[model samples]
Structures are given as structure tokens and as C-alpha cells.
Target: MSKGLREYAIVDIETTGGSAERSRITEIAIAIHNGVEEIERWESLVNPQQPIPPAIFGLTGISDDMVSDAPLFSEIADTIYALLKDRIFVAHNVNFDYSFIKHQLGEAGWQWQAPKLCTVRLARKIKPGLPSYSLGRLCDVLNIRVQYRHRAGGDVTATVALFNLLLAADSEMVFSQMLRKNGVVQRLPANLSQNTFDNLPVTAGVYYFHDRSGKVIYIGKAINIKKRVAGHFSGHNIQAKRQGFLQEIYDISYERCGTELMALLLECLEINRLWPKYNRALKRVEPRFGLVSYTGMDGYQHLSLTKLLKHQTCIQSFYSLREGAAVFRKMISDLGLDIRFCHFPLEVRLPQTANDLVRRIQDLPDQELYNGKVAAAVELAKADTSSYFIVDRGRDEQEKSCIWIENGKFYGMGYIPSESQSNSWADYKSELQRHHGNEYMMQLIESFLAKSNSRHQVITIDAEQLDEAAILKPVELRMKML
Candidate 1:
């Protein structure tokens, strides 16, 4: 934290994947700056002890062949530690790159530590109302040349340039903001600006957003409202129209809770009672269907769908019945599920063509274009039923969960835990039997259980209750059974 990038250690790392706890670093770069002057630069290739997925190789151009003979992080541990220690760790998405490297260093028996700063967060504060703050996007907007897009060295250098631009754009405000002992109190989306939310306690709490008319437009709860609400206003998801609308409001309010569980309970109570229009997460007052069950010759079998009724443990609430159904179909196809028993007409096969997908996309509100162009985008999105899997970490070191999703919807989810004798898929099947018949619970379970990466068996909760101990307890109990 200096007036002009003081002794900054702007850093970046190309990694095998996203999670530091699970993935490995493939490359690293550090650019040291004294004020605005570059003091030195360093870069290296690292042996990740894992195969570089072909997709990542294609993205970063750092392949297994390229890194096979590179120095393992252990060999360069001392050098990296010395290079970064006491220097401000800076990057585009600083935490991501920093965490990956720090985790790697720790595994190599070196505890890497450094104060961190993110260009993405800074750019949002300085250059608001942009289409994107991604390092590449920002570079393009600012006309800053980056020779390597995904490579560590290329990205670090670009981040330094971007960070410099942000500083130049608003030197007084940005620098003054940084001077605080605590992190900067960033400009919240219009409604929350009157209050310095940064000083808002990190304890569990429910935060409220009020429209200019004094109507409660949204209510949200988080373990750290300071962090979570900041995310909503951070301008990360630019395409979210609702966020823009919320930004237009002029007042904010909040209530604190002793624990995240209490915050969650309060949030559920307030959202149901207040019925805010802008609170997307809790706007609707209904359960979403997950699966449809019926009696069969063998026994009761559950079929996944999106239609939901009351009295079941609903997982995710949807905007409409159509949206819910779309989520269900996406999940069903992702899990390679059959359509016959789920109550739909037997011939309602997964749409495999542009026309079929177009019809489906026609149902959701158009997100991409003007007027009638939604028909076109749906045609494009539905052309493929790309299958994907969610890998979740389990309760113990050796255990993990695999949640399969297809086409951006919930599908069947399975659990994986440590212990050679336990079968996670089997445990999931049993849980499905007990909870599957309930429509709301089924979709909730499917969506919550679904995972894109198998890093560790992580608990599934709403974005708001991500840190609630009460909510996590059931998840842990279920994991214990497996």
C-alpha cells in the first residue's frame, strides 16, 4: 500500500484448475515496482505433479510437455518465498492467484504470506459501469498490450499496468481509501452509500436494501454482510439487470445476528414476510419441484422435474414455472436421466437440435438481445447438451462428492467420502429414496449437490447461507452417513 504502487509485488500464476486446496500451480511471475518504476521482474515454470488438462493447456499454452521438466515448487520454494515476502501481492483476481501459490508453497513446506490487492476490485471502484473488469477485458479497454493472456508472467505484467491505470484515474480517492487501517470502504451500489458498509461488522447479519420510495426492495443475509453485499455491488456480474436496478435505489438498512444460523433464520423470516421485489434469491414465495414420483411394479421411483408444490423441503426457488421446468430438463439431461417415469409424456426427449432448443429457450426471458432476438440465442444455446460433473470435497481428507449437472440445470448428485468400504453413489441413492419423492427437495438437493469441480466434499447452501453453521450441520450429518 503506497502512494504510487510502492514496492509492489504484482503477481500472477497459471494453474491446473481453480481451487488452491485441490489444484497445482504451473507457472508464476512477479513484477516489483518502486512507486511507478519497475524495480525487477521474475518468472518461472513449475512442475504441478499433475497432468495439465488439455483445455487448460489450450488456454494457457502451458502443456504437460512444457512443464514436465520444470522445477517443482519445492525446488524454487526459497526463491519464491524470498521474492514475495513483505511485498504487496497484487494481481487481477489477486486472491485466486495468491491462494494457489500460497497453497503450493505450503505443500512444499514453505508458508508463503503477503498482503494482497486485486485489480478487479480496484477497477470496479475506479472504472465503474464497464462491461467487464477481467484482466484481458480491462487491458483491451485501456489499450494496454498483453503478450500472454493466460500465462503467469504475461498476466502479472498486464495487471501491474491495469493497476497503474486505476491509480492514475482516481489517485486521491483510491489512495485515501487504501490508507485506512481496515480495507477501503468502497462505494456501494447507490442505495448503501450513505453508510460506510466496510466498517459494518463481520458478524452474521441480515442486510436490507430499500428503493428510493422507501420500499424494501431486497433482503439478504450473510455471515459477513460486509463481504457478501460487497460482492453484489462489486460489479462482477455486469450482465445482471437486477443489480443495475438495485444500484439505482437510494437507501439501505440492516439487522445483525449473533451467529450465521440466526442470520439465516431471520433472513428466511423477513423475506417471506416482506416479499421484496428486488430480492432475487427470496423474491418468490414457493417451492420448486425437483422430481416427480409414482408407484411402480418394484417400488416407488422418483423422476426429476422442475414443477413444485408446497409442503416439501424446496431447494431452489425459481422465477416462474417455466424457468423451473427448464432447470429440471437441463438437470435431467445432464444426469443422463430417463424421461418416461417423470410424468412428462414419454416422447419428451431431451432436445438435441437447434430447433428443439430454440423452443425451450423461447420460454425464458431473453438475456442477450433486444426484442425478438431471444429466439435466436436460444437456438444457439440449445445446439449442444454438454455434460459436466461437480466434484465436491468430503468431510475427511480422502472423501469427496461428485454432483453431475447437464446444460446448466440440476441432475442426479452423488456423494463420495473417505473410506474404501463406503460408496458415495450408493449413499446418495438411499438419501434420494428418503427425500427424492418430495418435489421441492429434489430440485434443491440436485442443484445444491451438483458440482463443477471435485476439489473437496463441500457443503451445499444458498449463496446467502454459505456460512451458516445450522445449515451446514445437516450437510455434515449426511456426509457422516456416507
Candidate 2:
């Protein structure tokens, strides 16, 4: 347990193949060391109980016939434990040997875990800019003599020598920091230091990835910052660009949003503001095409899907021309508006000219009905006061999160207690934690309200029960669960 003397066990194992999940170890060697000097050494051949592929035999030079009569790992598991028990396990690519030993030990009735160091990672820091960090290439570059190339005893002895050299060169304790986070966390982006990982918050927020030149290259929103950021680098199917992205990332910055809704809205707004290279949405600056109502010279109200003209009022905006067409088509069908007047391309006999179409539209009863529908839709879409709440999953069974709004302004968001007397704004506000809300927060409220009908629970509070004074005084939250 004592690291004062820098005691470690340099371990190397020749496995049947590349994966610990599918391959079994064929040979093992260990050299216990106290930083600069080797203390004890051990080596053994093991019964892998599996056919050694010809490719592996060619690469490692360990034939199946050699280990045919060798004892199964169960026979020597006790001896392996004695060697690695408290010593920091060290290897060229430590995870390879560490994982093999750890897994094999678990099946041999021993739980094995130890502080680990990878000399590959260490050599990169001590003598960097090497073209490759593979054990063979690295040892050759450093001029460390490898007695035997693929054999366990020879490779582990070379690892021991490399470890001692790294120990002498490590002035910053990089090896110690490498072992700080246990398990597969070592898969983190190599350039991301432990200090950066330690500072990540476990809260809802928007995180930005900045490249070496301090330009934000990517931005993301997450409910748990650490897990989400770690996930970006943890997977096995890492693409070339993904690897480059990790290497290019020089710094990370984050803003904690008090609620997930705020986090989502802020992510959307920041993506639009920055237009980061990785962002796809909200990058276009042009206003979307919309269905607008304008009175023509013939005094007929016409619904046109196009860039709104000066003094024209928009009925609704659509991100794509197709969406606008669909809504316009539905409007024309619902009100029985003539396609010839709306300028829709048709195969049948069409109005000869624009003026003639306007005259036909103005002369029809359909224009009046269309105008009335537009008026009613506009009124229904207006967000005055008392019709908004941002509801998301609760922290626990007895809780629910709600962000309250009134008169199109944010009141605040907080946990809703299961036992409630009234659903008044004041009652909800008393339980709510207030925030310095912004335009994005208001937009989030509106968007959630529009989408809640199908995807979310629409909890309708009795508006008549909430008197004008109730918005201000003693709280009682009553609700009609819808």
C-alpha cells in the first residue's frame, strides 16, 4: 500500500488473441520492482484451453504444443495474487495485461484490483513526439534493449526497465494522475487532463468544446455534464474526425441552467448565436417563410406563403417551403378557397391574369369565411397570461418540476409537492425557485406549451379559482389533472 518507495509489479501476459472477453492468457511474467531496482521475478506457461490461431502463433511465437501440459491458471492464481496484491501494476499498455489478470483472477476465486500505470502513456509525456507508442516501436525509439520480442518474460523485463526510466523522468507525477480515475475512464480523450475532468459539474447545463485557437467547435446540452462529456470519448467505434476533435479540443466552458428546459433553450440559442462547425440547426439567419394575410386591391383577404411584404401580418411560420405548402393547402381546403385565386399551379383552366383572380376572390363568399378563420386562429395563438407551465420529470416519486409563467413572462421553476391545496400561481410561486429569466426561457415556455398536447401531460389548473388577488397572496394550489 505504501507508494513512498514506489513499489510496483511490472506484468505482461501473452493471450490467445486481442480481446480479454474472448481470449485466454497463454503465458505470464511478473517482475516486482521498487522504482529503480527489481525485487522479485516470476514467469509461467498456462493452459489456455483454446486453439491458438496461426496468426497469433506467428506474431507471439508461442505454439499451443508448448502450453499443452501446463497447469490451468487456477493452480497458480495464488502465486499471481501474492505478486500483485498491493503493488501498482505496470505494463507497456497496462490495460491489456491488467484486464487479463483481473478477469482471470476473478474466475480463480480471487478479486483482483490494483493501481495501474501505462508506460505507453508515460513515455509519450516524458519523451513525446514519437511517431508511434506501440511497445515495440517505443522501446526501439528509446534504445531500451528488448531481450526477447514477443515472449512474456522478455517483454515484461523490458517493461520493467522502461518503467524505471519513466519513473526517473517523471517530475510532474503524471503516472500518479493517470491512475486517479479507475476503470475504463482511461478511455477519456488523451489531451483532456484529470483537472478538467474533476471540475465538470453534475447538473443541467450547456457545454462548449473549444479548439486550440479558442473557437467553439461544438456545443451540447446535458442533464449530467460529466456523463455526457465523458460519453463523447468513451465509445469504441471512434471515427477519424472524432479522434481529431478530441485532440483539437483545448478547453471547455459551461453555463449551468437551473432547469432542463432552460438548458435545452440555451443550447438552441447558443448554437444559433455561435453557428459552431458541428451544429446543424438554427444556423440559417433568414426568417422562415410563413403564411401571411394581406388585403388585396379588390378588398379580399388572401393567405399567401412567402416572405412577408411590408405591412403584412404573418399567420404562422414554417421552417421549410413544403411545410408552408401543407398548411396553406389545408387552409384552402378547409375554407373552400379557390386554388386559381391563391396562385397555386394547377393543370385545369386557370385565371388568365392576377387582376382577374383578385376580382374572382373579392366576389366570393369564401373570402369572408377565410378572413374569419384567420382571425380566430390568431386569437387562439396569442399567449397572454395564465396559460403556460414547463413540466419535466421529477427528482423523485413525490415530486414534479414545473416552471410557471404569467402574462408571457417567467415567474420561475421549482419542485411541485404531491400534496397541494391549490393550483394558484402564488401557491406554485411559493414552492418555485426564482431565476433571472431571458428571451430563450420565454421561447422555451411557448414551445413546450405548443407541443405538450400529444407528448406531455397537460395539467390544467382551474383559471377561475385563481382570483386576481390569488396571484399575489396566501397560496393554495388546486389543479384539474388532464
Candidate 3:
């Protein structure tokens, strides 16, 4: 190849398995092209030095017996590096091949880096709107015959032909633009389209990544949808799971939220509802400890710290045993109740006078007085569970967003118009979308409310106010100013 002439090395390899870190190449083929025609070609079978899995042998038809006498990658690394040193690397799903070769080369003491062009992405740009872009399906659609289907040599030949077609049909100079160092197109996954990425909105929203079968694989919340999605593809991570995740993403869809808080709430709800494969953070989360009330044989209502139990109501739920114990200790201290009746986790530290208190419990005669104090404490603990609305900025200027907490549980959230004239809570409830709430959702709301600088306003309402005609009068006036 002469200087100043654009050259590409169309390459293909048959590997032992899908992961580059865990698999090795068994066969390789390369076709060198200088803009218009092939200048050189090379093909070889490599002794991977590892047993090929039966599945890979079935796919490529290259068994251990066939590669017994072949050259190891170390023996041919120099030749392979020389041929691809300064040329653009082209392949179907380029990253998969690139990662395998790059990892092997580094192991052989040759660090290599080159520009890559994925024919799958190029075809999508050049041809526009093909139903499927898998090598076999695409060739069948275009009437380009592929022989020796999964073998390296035959796949390289078919790829060369595909590259030629893409070059000829690329009237918009997309190839040249993608070759630029700063182009995002070069970093995107082969199955994802530039148009789909470009269409992501720069606003707070919940985004979904769908696989080829249109099943949601991941769900996330973002303050800026475009920037956050772009971050997922920005790194050069070669882990098998990360690589597989990138390849699985074939489409993206998003739902815009009025505020970051609303986006977070929606993300939690959808993740729980859909149980997407890539969502692991919130799925396993729940309150770990609870403060429950039990009636002992002595006819006294007792307060105790216990592990979260199903089918039993808790006076308060906490994320940690220490937190629950601290609250329980304070309630006992404030109500002047005997500590002997209260059960605590083994890790909890009791006060210095606990032994004396336990001895005195056997002599106590008035159970009614102690029961009254326990009941009063329980009522105080439930006082925080008031029905309220968290009002915040809406998606636009025409409305405001409201998150409803019914009797201290998240009911739902939605946007209400600035000029609404509804008078009762029933009318407001009809405007909101309902969602199932969990302990994690309550924790999020509580944390947000605890923030001293939070801009959202809280509107507390009692059961009696739900039927009043003037319940929303003040809230309506507040919405207009928002």
C-alpha cells in the first residue's frame, strides 16, 4: 500500500467461546484493501492450546483434531501486527473481534491500537432501515452469497463484499466522518443506531434499553437522558458481561418526568414492575428491622425490635437494627415504661440500670398504667404517617407535579394543570396515576423531605378534609404561582 492511500484490513476470526478474556481464537483471515481493490490476503489456523467447547466446534466446524498441528498465535503475532499496524480495522460486530485480538496481542508482548469500523453499523447508516443486520440474514436480503458460513476465510470474503457495497452507497460520506477521532459513531454498539442515540432528550427521564426481541434488559433514571446514555458506551471496558450487555442493546425508549424526584420514583416503580435483567440495585432492597407490638401472657402490650415479618404490621420500619433499637429505647425512656418487657436485638447495648429494672419488673402490680403508656407511645409513633402531597416543578410551565402519600404510603404521582379548579381530594386523585409502594420508596421520600434545602412543598391533609369542597383552594393558588 502506498502512502496517502486509504487502506482497510477486513478481518474475521473463529473463537473458542464468546468472551475474549476466557476464550482463544482457533482460525483467522484477513483481506487488505486499498480503497477500491484487494491488495493482499492471509489465512491461518491457530493452535489455541485450549480445548474448544463443543458448541463452538459445532458453529465453526473447526475441531481440536483440525488445529493440532497449526501455529500458535505467538508465532504469527508479528505478521498480524504488521499487516494491521496503520490500516483501519473492519469487521462485523467489530468490538468482539477487536477485544479478543487486542487481549491476545498484549499477552504476546505486542500492544496494539487501531481505528475500527463495524460493518453492521456502517450498513445501517448506508442502507437505512434493513429488517435484520446479522451477517447471514443481511447477505440473504442483499442477494450476496456466503460460502463456508462460520469459517474465518469465507466470512472475510463476504465482509469485503459488504464493505465495497457500503463504500459505494455511502453518498453522505458517513465512513469518512466516522473515522474521525472525536466521532461518537465509532464508539457505539454495532446493533444500536446513531439516529436512536441522537433522538434521546436532554431532560430528566426514565430510560429503557431493549434487546433484539424487544424485551427490556435494563431500566435507569437520568437527569439528562442523552448524556447518561452516552456515558454507558464511553468506556473501553472489556469484561465479558459488559461486552455482552453492549451487544444486547438493540433499541432504547424513555418516559420524561417532570422533576428528578419524579424520575427516580418512576424508575423504582418500573424496575419492580418489570424486573429487568440488568437492574439489581433496588430489587433486593427492603427494610431490615421493625418495631412491633405483642401482647404477653401478663396482659401487657409490649414493644420489641424484631426482624421484618410478613403478615404482621410494624409500628415503625427501619433499614438497620441499630436504628430501630435507638428509636425503641427512646420511646421507652420517654414513656417511663419498664425495659424488662421490651425485647431488643443481641447487639443492642442496654442502659447501666437495666439489671435493677429487670428485678423490679417481678414486683410491679399495676399492668393497666403501663399498658396505657404503651398505647400512647404507639399512637405517637403513628402520628408521622399523615396523608400529604409533595408539590414540585412540572415538566413545563403550564403545570405542577404532585406526589401523593395516602395515610403515609406512596399512592402515585402526576402533573396537575396550573389553572385547575377541582375542589376535593377525590378530584385530585383522579388526575394522578397510581403505583404500588414499597419500603424503599418510603425511604426515598423520607430522605428527600429531610433535606434542609429541598424546594418541594408538603401539603398535609386529614381524612375529614377529603370530603370538604375547599380542600384544594390553597393548593390551587400555590400551583398558579409555580
TM-score top scorer: 3
Shift in Å, residue 292, candidate 1? 26
TM-scores of the candidates in the order shown:
0.46, 0.48, 0.83
Per-residue lDDT tens digits for candidate 2, residues 126-223, read: 76777766678877888989987899999998888788778787887776666665454465444444467669998888899887578999999998
Candidate closer to the true structure by lDDT (higher is better), 2 or 3: 3
lDDT of 1 by residue, 333-381 (tens): 6544334333433344444432343334335333333222423323433
Q: Write the per-residue lDDT of candidate 3 for residues 261-332, one digit (tens) a residue.
A: 899899999998899998987888878898888899979888888998765678888887866777788887
**True-structure Cα RMSD, model 2:** 13.8
Query: Candidate 3: lDDT of 240?
Result: 82
Better of 1 and 2 by TM-score: 2
Highest lDDT scorer:
3
Q: Is candidate 1 or candidate 3 better by TM-score?
A: 3
Candidates 1 and 2, the one with greater lDDT:
2
Candidates by TM-score, descending order = 3, 2, 1
State the displacement of the C-alpha of residue 262, model 3, in Å, after optimal TM-score superposition.
0.7
TM-score of predicted structure 2: 0.48
Candidate 1 global CA lDDT score: 0.59
